[model samples]
Target: MAGAFEEETNLYNRIVLGSLLPEGAWEPLPHWLQGWLRNYIGGTLVYFISSFLWCFYIYYLKRNRYIPKDAIPTNKAMLLQIAVAMKAMPFYVVLPAISEYMVEQGWTKCFASIDDVGWPTYFRNLALYLTIVEFGIYWMHRELHDIKPLYKYLHATHHIYNKQNTLSPFAGLAFHPLDGIMQALPHVMALFLVRMHFRTHIALLFIEGIWTANIHDCIHGKLWPVMGAGYHTIHHTTYRHNYGHYTIWMDWMFGTLRDPEEDEAKKM
Candidate 1:
């Protein structure tokens, strides 16, 4: 067991450090900038690539009529939302640094590699972490709405697109910095609760970033039991229902779930 662990650790070190830093690579960059590049550059790339792909998918879905397009935002509105998202970049960049700090402080358990734990355990941990995150965010999101001051000063910026088609993937992060941090607390919380592989941790962050945007794209469909864009679209429209992040379970349990299609059907 000890030998296997050491082998995995060596493999992870090789993959992460070997690829990130060639011999004397840091000599060219200042010490401060080295940390930024080492810790944040990959995350920034993930954000850019994920945001781009999500936007492209949104456009493709709309163009193909795979999704309805009633409340699509104007180019001006989209650009404004993109600008708002830019404000969140610094916050996003800092999160990984915080994670690294937690690991250094022995407050978080981050495995060196996935093979150190095997796929089944890794996936189980992933699902558990996601569930915990969803539960945390659900309550936090609800509180943001129920609390008058929080809603007005923080969350309201995100709710500007209060109807279908008024949102895009970029609008997902177009939030007040406080609002963005509050919503992101789940990721931080998960780090402490689970023994996550570093690679898995980064992958989940990538997924969370992309998924947050996907839910705002207004595509409107159920991705199995997971509530997709439709669930969130209603939240934007009504500002009261569907406060759960990924699943309707939390909303249903808390009696805040309001199915938009079902409600519309009832009117007829």
Candidate 2:
């Protein structure tokens, strides 16, 4: 057992430092093809589950409570409303991609064996992947807001859900079908540039899964409610600012984020 363990550790080290992973850990598919598969599967699952569940959730909310049905979607708007429920798909499709890119640039490496499964390595990689994903998404999303034609053609669909609440993430699905494809652009770039093994790719995906869902599923109301949708709501309602994708840190870094508190306090 000890000898077997040592062999695995040595193999992990070699793989992390640009050496080919042991035969069991590596494969030869073209990165683009691999990424294509990754994107398809990711996009498919997110759409399937999120769309069904969100619509159901929206139905439940509408049925149970009263948000002044006057503000509820019109019949025509209802179609759009349900459509936006598919927002989770883009997140699934876009995130595995960074692993592909970071590996290509040699900025990231994968390890197999025991160390890769440990908590420390998990968190470390989580931070690294999140930072990379946020950076790519932040700029791309900012462009979606700041750029004129693309926003009009591609992103306007998600604006339908400005109503607020758990269903808000559904707004993303109303996006032009092309908008879905465009969201994958970052992942495509990441896959082409990075060269991660499948395990790392899965880990990154898991991290992003929760964050993206929170953007719409849970991020509503005010900023003070701890990760409310207020910031993202401003993005959709006004479409002027707060283009950061997830982390407060990135929004702060880019100066694109809107902070109503600061402005309001100044007025006081």
Candidate 3:
């Protein structure tokens, strides 16, 4: 067990410190400090780059959008959302770092290469991870709503933008620090539950960052079985339905899924 632990530790050190840092840049740091720098700084850097790109794409390039132009949040509101996101960045950074350390310690599975695991195993693990995360967040989200105090203190900040165009990709992480952490708890938990390649972990996080923004773009359409911006938009507007993050299965199962189009037709 000790030998296996040492091998995994060495592998993580090489992948995280070796690849992410300049040659010799990490050598001078104390052992504890090396871990801190690699996990915290590296995690923050990845999230920052992903967040910036997604925000830029949505606000600048994706001009013709689902929400009408006039209904979009004003520049001031968007700026406030960005500011809140910045304040909440530390939670985002620290969680991934903690997860990485867990992986290194063998509390979670980690592979050095996708080839090591084979393509079929890699895909299965990815699916399993997503399911775990979605299941966790769905229940936690519903609990946040059911518990009045939790909703009032934690989840309310995210609901501030209750309209379509008022949300952007930036709004995705603009949650209160506690709320942000809660939403992300599933990702961390999934690491412990499933064996995954390091590359798969990174890919899942990257896709999640982009998907969070896409779901808030106010576009009305499902990504087939996967819930899309339209499904989430209704959640923002109604605050009573469509609570699952990536899939409609939970909401459908629990009877919280509301179809906006169908509701509109009934009103007419």
Candidate 4:
């Protein structure tokens, strides 16, 4: 009976936390602490930190965008909108609704609870969902450009950055409400489709918030210190192609991985 109880307890902890813990680190903390961290701190912290960093980066991008080096420009107005999303979005819209939805479903799972899966398996499933989410954003971004009349109203704001800055990418969020919502819609759909583990759901959302903000960094477009980026900058530079927000695979697939000829002309 004791061993059975232990297994059940371990299962609960695992499902409540899908991807937060790495493989074989610390043992699980107590339930009360887990609840506090997951419910109170994690969600708010991710949003706030991502939002503030976004503001600062945008500010930095603004000061530097005008230079002629390999650098890009940032948009001031777009920065403010990113700031607004931090407050208006998490407080007014997303968190409250997600909380309520969880209660209604009686899932007790916070965001994307993984009730039965372990580490590799959970991430494997999550990869599928994340891919789906990325595809949605890719297509939506494509529509904004491919369609003419909508371009001026929906997509032009992001193009304000001639080069690329962390700030200018999010600055485009204020462009059109549809743009922000469209970016988020995929995650929401993925959660429903897979019954994501609650906390994982929240973590993924936080990732999206930070992921979008980071790619827009005015630097050479590396999402992190590593990884491929700059493609978004290519989009801003040419104002024609390379629209994926996260990874460049889609851009490469579509034949938009920066033009050598155009890069030279812009330099000239």
User: What is the descending TM-score order?
Assistant: 1, 3, 4, 2
Q: In terms of TM-score, which candidate is stronger, 2 or 4?
A: 4
- What is the full ranking by lDDT, best candidate first? 3, 1, 4, 2
On TM-score, the stronger of 1 and 4 is 1
TM-score (C-alpha, index-matched) for candidate 3: 0.81
**What lDDT score belongs to each candidate, Candidate 1 first?**
0.73, 0.51, 0.74, 0.53
| Model 1 clashing residue pairs (backbone) | 71-165
Error of 4 at 55 (Å): 6.8
Each candidate structure's TM-score, on Cα atoms with residue i matched to residue i, is 0.81, 0.58, 0.81, 0.60
Task: List model 3 lDDT by residue over 167-234, tens digit each.
Answer: 76667767888887788788888777887776557556646666776777676674567788778888
Candidate 1 residues lying further than 4 Å off, grouped into runs, are 1-44, 60-64, 67-70
Model 1 C-alpha lDDT per residue in residues 65-119, reported as the tens digit of each score? 6555555666787788878877776766566556655654556766766787899
Q: lDDT by residue for model 4 over 9-61, one digit each (tens)? A: 34544654544656543246654344433433444455557645765654555
**Candidate 3 Cα errors over 4 Å, as ranges:** 1-65, 115-117
In model 4, the runs with Cα more than 4 Å from the true position are 1-48, 51-115, 164-172, 221-229, 259-268
Model 2, 1-268: lDDT tens digits are 3343334433433444224234534235444444534454555556446644754565465453533344333445545554554454444444445444444444544433435456765666556655676677777777776788987877766664654442333444445556644554554455333333335555445444334444654224454533345566566666767666555566777676676565347779
Q: What's the distance in Å from true for residue 122, model 2?
A: 3.5
Clashes (candidate 2): 15
Poorest stretch of ten by lDDT in candidate 1: 1-10
Candidate 2: lDDT of 118? 69
